[model samples]
Target: MRSLSLSNLLRHHKHTAFGHDDSHLPRQVIEVAIDDSEDTHELPARKRRGRAQSTAGTIKGVIRRASLSLKGMVHVHRRPSVTAEPSDLNQQLPNGRPTSAHHTWNRLRHAAPFRRSRSVYGLNGTEDGLYEQQQLDHQMPIPAMGDEPPYIPMNTGAAAKASVALQNEYYNRQAMHTQWLQSASEDSNDRESGIGIVVTEPFMESGVSDDGSMLGQDSNISRIDFIKELPSELAIHVLAYLDAAALAKASVVSRHWNEVVRNQHIWRESCLREMTTTYATSEPVQPGAGLGIPEIAPSKNWRQIYRAKAELAQKWKEGKACPMYLNGHTDSIYCLQFDEYKIVSGSRDKTIRIWDMQTLECRLVIGPPEVVNAPNVLEDAEGNPTHYVNLSDSYKAAPSKPQVASFAEHHKASILCLQYDDEIMVTGSSDSTCIVYDVRNGYRPIRRLTHHTAAVLDLAFDDKHIVTCSKDISICVWDRATGALLRQLRGHTGPVNAVQMRGNTIVSCSGDFRVKLWNIDTGRNIREFVGHTKGLACSQFSEDGRYVASAGNDKVIRIWDANTGECVREMRAHDNLVRSLHIDSVSGRLISGSYDTDIKVWDMETGRQLLYFPRWHASWVLSAKSDYRRIVSTGQDPKILIMDFGADVENIEMLKSANTGIGGIRL
Candidate 1:
């Protein structure tokens, strides 16, 4: 009887272990227990049934051992369903314990035979375990109860093949990248074209687009993108070597390229390299000039500066400008100095006038000490007035202010030349004297230097000394503060027309048809630049002191190496005498003003004429000066024509009509 009872109990337990219905459980829990990975596993039905039977036996043994030998045996029981809802059944517990179905499912899931199959995959002839893992990796997660199961991929066979292809592709890509890095490391020039690696993938192929833009939709990845990926400093260093034209072209490559190209320091370097000769490093800041204007700032962005100057230069070359006539002087304008704000012009009328740049009104008139009207107006050999005639103005305008100060007692003759820095101004006169005025202290004459026997023709000064060249065929270097002559240089046989002093060097051009470089302190002629057949009217040392540019009565402009005294380039600039010359060191532009009334701009490097302003002045252009922004020229005409290269005047027809002689513009 005992044996029969044990046998019956064992049989009941065996049926309960594998035969109990799990249909009432929630769908999600059922799917988790036997996910699609299990379904896709291609095991024969007999094999699956055998494994299930073995799992049930193992659970039965575990339960029997627990009931007989363990101190606390755990048993699961289920309560009667409340609404026949599978979700409700999942939530409920029998006798306040885990459900029997959950316990049985877990026991069957972790059975020794089932675990062994999963642990060792594809070693034998079956695709059950390995296939399950690959499918699970790509499978959709199971849905909760009341939700339909998503389309779970059961492509175990296909996934296995794809896994092998993916491994092969990854290894091949790695090898290609390694080779590229090795080659790039060996030769740095290879990296300039950007790093390239040919990655061949079975799913992707390379192709081109219609617009020439890189269209890397699937394959054919562009290596140019790697340049954008470089660190900004390194990328800028690489691009710094490109000239302005190349850099401008590169800016249009892409949005990222444009953004990188606008970096401030990059343009700053280029500006310093190309425009160093023209832009002043130590110009003083003027009042009312720097109100949020970048050009007047202490450390302005070089890109903005370069663009403004380039545009102005283009306009100057084009001759697209309207004339502004400043009418105040009663005689020919002899010498002038100007900046952006004001034009200070001296005339043979025995007066100096300071004109406002914007309004064209004479701000202040500086006459001689006592107003003396000549009994007879001087006449030329042809009976025409030797002095200039005032340009006819239909509209009459008054001076803005009366003469600020008159020094008729100090200067007996016309003011020939003048220059001023921040603290002082020096003026040379036909009275054979030079006057140093204290600009910081009410513009009063501080020193009256008298030594020259003939009229002072031109003068140059620094803080320490004043250099004066005269019709007496001599040059005088004087101590500016003491009004004492320091050294007298007697070299030119004819009157010296122009002189420029830079540091210890003084360069003078004379009517003797010679240009000389001298040491101002020692009174020694450093070198003589001799090539012109006619008298040299103007000369200037370049900003770097490497070259000297001079123009003369011969109507030719010559550039000489200051060190070698070699005539490097010569160009016939004007039909008449070339009276004045200015070297725009920042732009490498040589500006020549001529008695022919033409103001021409030339390329200093090639001696090629860049622009020809025919009849820029109504009469002989006596003196001209320029800053980066504008050019102010004075002539035998009473009006001081301010040719504002900065002006935005556009006239294509005027530019075409201006070319008269000199083979047109070189570029």
Candidate 2:
């Protein structure tokens, strides 16, 4: 395991982190270590021995064992004891030689990977033993033949001079360390005395079994998971060399491998190096506003979390998914969304249902409150609600509030679209209104938005604004806190079927065959996209507001560049009108639902269709949304379809803990 451990440690961090081939790391000492290793590793060990030839302590026992086991080869090429280099191995060492310090470094560097393969070694060609490296070393140019200049070409003048200088520096540092050790040792006699120098004979001679058949350890050594014999800290240090995939494979070898591989140190490094997550965002990040990679919570199980991320990614790539049906809604389901705890869906059954995410049990079923009529509400000739009470201060002062119309808990009509954050849930409906529910307080009705004249087709909200599009060919922007109409946008010549918001920008698709961008605050047109040959039913604005996506009667999805108002990509796969589309900004996948009864996932960047399901919904697929784990789609079918990418991922709950919010990825 020692040689296997050393090789993994070097290959993983050295070549992988410091990148030699495609890497420009100042520490390219690696490529030299494998192909042309000669200098740095040996200089320090040789220097220490030259200074205190007789002094020994902890190193004495180690050297004795190494001498017996390795038979004499260890001294020339490998680290036999504690090593100090010019500094770095970063600064102190020259030719990359694996140091005991490098091993510790492999531990430290891997100990805490931030969000950020192996060469199998040994005679067995498994990464668990160390025999063949002895044979492989002989293949390298035989160490130096007593100072015959050098094997690396010194034919070029500049190359020769530089090599000479580096060689000189190597000797100079070694001499300095030797002198320092000599000075330090002169005063100390407490260490092992140099008098009785003990040495041992090799286990085999004249082509005998070096497997230690003579010592009876042959059975033990052959079966040992070499890592088990080392101290706990040392074992962890050794295991750190293996990547997540390798660590997982090593765990099944034996109980000991399983135990050592579970070390918090090993997985912590793996998580940091491989795990990544994003902060909770109610909506896309606004311009000049962004969240950095979220730090993993220390309370979670990182190993299971790592595994789930790995498997889920593969599942998405291969279009492998497990399906579960949510069948509570009695009529066509129009919209749905899920978070860590629950799935909240709105349906044409005039109801809202929240399903427990894990058990698929109906947690709560709510619908429009019983209302006699819309109270004290008047409409203009165009049918827009004219008289709406600003009830914030009224409700705050008088805790017992009077009914604001017998309004929507509040959708009195079929709910069309909805969005929720931690505190409240907002639903739009054919009732020409939006209702806000206090999600934290038993789903109580709080505010009502009566700004649209026609059916509210879709809605999106952020911290400040609630944006809603309507079949009235108008879009209304409202203040989230006060429920006051902020701005009414009028541009689409036909009913605005879908709307999406990212920071200050809003994207809306209309039946008029046009897609437009608008500034939520200024209420002015930013740009317009016109590539669809027919009406657009659904649209999405990228998190950065640089791209817009829309689909409708044209039976295709067009990716638009918001700045240029140009359709950049026309992704065609649907056999009928595409109804709903969403982009998972975290994964860069475009999920679309269509009347064709198909839902397809696309690589938004490449404009290539990745996964497609023919008839995922039995009828017109109305809406679809996704995160890293699953895609949630609702359609003309009474049932909602959940394509759970994590269904087969073991210990999925642990993965959810790390995925605190949407758009987080662990790879």
Candidate 3:
């Protein structure tokens, strides 16, 4: 028969005493120790063989002994040694062997009757509620001194309510972690297990200890740095979606996140997205043109470039400007023209002065020329002829007609209007003639054609011809090569104020309140646009010659279809008469100056005002011109106002306006 040990009987009694179930316990094996020296001699060969065959019967005998009622056996096998150290603690017994400590604790702790208490584990007062309340306190957003209010996420249409719900949910999950820690601290029995154990379920009074391992895992997750674990490539890509303002704020999150966000590609893509598209032609100089700024470069710092544009726009919008005094012209400046290099202004002082834009120095002044004849010669000591003072005098036969002092005495009266190209500059004047100067050849007068009976008001030219409008109510088409009047246009009943020509089309505005489109070669009116109630001041044909824009004393600007003469749109833009107008086809911006002392920039297509400089001119702004760098305006005030909007602003305006309509988008 199999024999059982005292320890095994004690384990059986402990299970029964605690009312613990053991129905699923594994089958037990009973071991009987025999002296090794007498094992084979004591048993017969046949008896030993039979013992080996009865191994199965021995296992069944142990199970039958365990099946006996433990209450009957406890009286026989109850051992007090289990509470102390036993010699056979490591010895194997029937079923699994129970250690001494396991037997002692099982008997002492499990045998006691279960009791419910209001508190346990030394926490009986507010201390227990304090831990729970502190965990819940995390749900409130702490007020920070200057920090922006928290960005509460919204998951529904009721943003405020949804955000509150989300905020609560977020904090509750966070509170779960703290509650888990409190539960862990309250249970002294669990900590002895080790870090490998965790409790996932949240701490609740009902059964927090049941899933303590799960709760530990949930709490430990709060310590993970999620953003820090993302790959740098993905981190940067995520940051690229943030706007400039948010990106600056995110950089302060942490050192590791900051480092990932500082990746150049992230800022590059952001800068590129915010920046307007720039074209090479919009720049003052081509890349190799040897000018102040090149159109293209091998590399670029996108951040600085974008910042410069943003700052420039900010300053312009704020009307923050440092006025530059170009102290020159003694009298009111009547007409002005400028390129990137210099500003050529005509003043009532009867002089045309060129001022270097960069140096702000008067480069040169062209005034009426003086003619001096050679003095009469006197005989020197060696019989060589010399002048009375020193040099010899010379003489040539004079012409029959009284000649003007010099050919370059360009005007007898004030220069009224001007137009120029790279090679030549043409100026019209009250002298009743238009003079063409060779700008490449010392600015000397190349041709002087007398055609108008009164002061010339405006002029435009190309390589082949120069067209001039005058107060005499006529337009003269002149041959650029020779001082010959090619054709006379005489249809206007009033003085023509402004005129512009493109290819075969000539558009002119007159005091008759009419905008006439003329064929320059034939000197005949192709069409007429009549809309202004008062006299027209300026007119221009669009570059493609499909449309014409006109503005005048009517305090209105109108755009008309060139072919059909249909009035497309009209804008009442000024409180006073508009004096001059210009259009930039590339940017689609129309600029107008008025007697109101204001200069406005407009969108020609939509007739929407984009920007306006109010009282930018101390006096009436007579004429204004704009390009990539600046807008140069000269008026009844002698001082020239150069509004430097910074380089490449035209490109920015173009990009920002490209997709807009009336009441359009703005940067």
How accurate locally, in lDDT, is each candidate?
0.60, 0.62, 0.58
lDDT by residue for model 1 (1-667), tens: 3223333333433344235344554554333333223321244768766755664666543443332221111111112233455664445332343444554334323322211111111111111111110113333222111222222235775544443443344344454344322222221112222323333322122211222233223234543454477899987877766657667755654557777788766775665455443432233222223211233234455566556545656776675654566765668989988754456788887776665554555555556545323322233345543222232445434333333466533576688899876567778888888877765554567778889998999998887988999999999998877878898999888989999988899999998899999998799998998899988889998877888998888888899988899999989888998988988765677888998999888888899998777886779999877655566788898778766555563321121111111111111
Error of 2 at 285 (Å): 13
Which candidate number would show the highest lDDT if scored against the true structure? 2
Tens-place lDDT per residue, model 2, 1-667, is: 3344333444544343425242442233333233332222344777756634553554543433332233223222332112333342333324553434434333222221211111111111112212112122112212122222242432577544543443343344344333222321222211221211111112111111212111212233444435656788988887777779789666644456777888777876666555443222344322112121223555666676566667778888999887766654668988887776567888886777666565555555576444222231223356643322222223211111112223334676888998887777899999998888777666678888897888999998998988999999999999989999999999889999998888788888899998888998899997888678998888887766667888899898888877888778888868889888888776678898889898899988889989998876789999898876788889998777888887777776564432322211111
> Candidate 3 on 22-60: residue-level lDDT in tens?
344552522221111222324577876675576446765
Candidates ranked by lDDT, best first? 2, 1, 3
**Best-first order by TM-score:** 1, 2, 3
Clashes of 2: 7
> Residue 568, candidate 1: how far off, in angstroms?
1.9
Candidate 1: minimum summed lDDT over ten consecutive residues — where? 114-123
TM-score of 1: 0.56
Candidate 2 clashing pairs, residues 3+ apart or interchain: 86-92, 87-92, 88-91, 88-92, 113-272, 113-273, 123-132
Instruction: Judging by lDDT, tell me the better candidate of 1 and 3.
Output: 1
